[model samples]
Target: MTTSFIARTTLAVAAFGALALAGTAALAGDQDFALLNATGYEIGELYVAPAQSSDWQEDVLGQDVLSDGQQANIKFSRDEDTCAWDLKVVYSEDNSSAEWSNVNLCELSAVTIKYDADSGETSAYGQ
Candidate 1:
């Protein structure tokens, strides 16, 4: 009886784990991507909005800061059908900002933001 109980519990746990993985797969969408900060400053705020949007959305980073050479996961629900996105970052050290537009999140799963304070320019690279 003890062996049977253990076997059933193990099977149930395995099934639950499979369901959890399926749910996670279903939640991943084209808008989900990794955001890498190669900028020379700590990012105090990060915003992502559809390219066609007139105004930037709420900061995706919230209270968290993305330090230089760090990465953050930017996820969107499966219902997000938009592919082209705009990104903006605000620096923590001086509050200077940078922006990128028309990034295709569907074709690119990762993005890196690079900044040059010398010329005050911002650029993005992705794969």
Candidate 2:
């Protein structure tokens, strides 16, 4: 009887452990991608659109300005836009980062940004 009880207890613990690990994996898989800004600009607006689409999705206002060393995490979804292609942004001193779905945004070949201080010079970067 003692051996049987011990075996049952061990099995129960193992089952619980498996459930916990499965839950963690599910949560991780659902996570959305985010853009990290370490510059001094306070983001005013953010936009995202597919590479093949001409329409851009305007993210809601109110974002944390990425200070020289601060970071913010955003959530995104493809259903929020019309094109459902990729991601883009138009920010100012007030807005900071835009979070969107469509993993292709992270894989952009180049990103262009127009800065006010640089007389509207467009800066580009690769993923």
Candidate 3:
């Protein structure tokens, strides 16, 4: 190839690589939030997933449990264009679970699970 053509091609490739790196960095930007257990019971498992996903991700708590009135830090990365998320938590005693759906992570700093003794139901909300 001509010297000018080769030089132009190399410059273009370098620019492309830089843009790709920038995009990757943006997509991998830090995402972290606190999970509060206010359901009047200990939380055994915590799962988070993108709103579009059908399956819940692995437990964020791992071997740890979030006791009532306790909070745990959860960290993850989401696409820059995606802001919706889902959170699920299971109670320690009976494996009963509660889920909060379509939560906008951009507007949420914490997730709290609430349980009602009268209705025997659990609900979650973002704060």
Against the reference, the lDDT scores of all candidates come to 0.65, 0.36, 0.61
* Model 1 C-alpha lDDT per residue in residues 73-108, reported as the tens digit of each score: 987853645666667777787666666666667667
List the candidate 1 regions with Cα displacement exceeding 4 Å: 1-28
lDDT of model 1 at residue 39? 70
Model 1 clash count equals 0
User: Which ranking of candidates, highest TM-score first?
Assistant: 1, 3, 2
At residue 84, candidate 3 shows an lDDT of: 59
Highest lDDT, which number?
1
How much lDDT does candidate 2 score? Answer: 0.36
The TM-score between candidate 2 and the true structure equals 0.39
After TM-score superposition, what is the CA distance of residue 49 in candidate 2 from its true location, in Å? 1.5
**Poorly placed runs, candidate 2 (over 4 Å):** 1-31, 60-65, 80-86, 94-103, 106-127
Candidate 2, after superposition: displacement of residue 103 in Å?
A: 8.0
lDDT of 2 by residue, 12-120 (tens): 1222222222111212213243444433354555555444455665663345443433444445444432212344443454233333333333233323232333332
TM per candidate: 0.72, 0.39, 0.70
Model 3 lDDT tens row, 6-92? 222211122222222211122333436788777678889988776658988688899999999999988775454555566677667
RMSD vs true structure, all candidates:
19.8, 21.5, 20.0
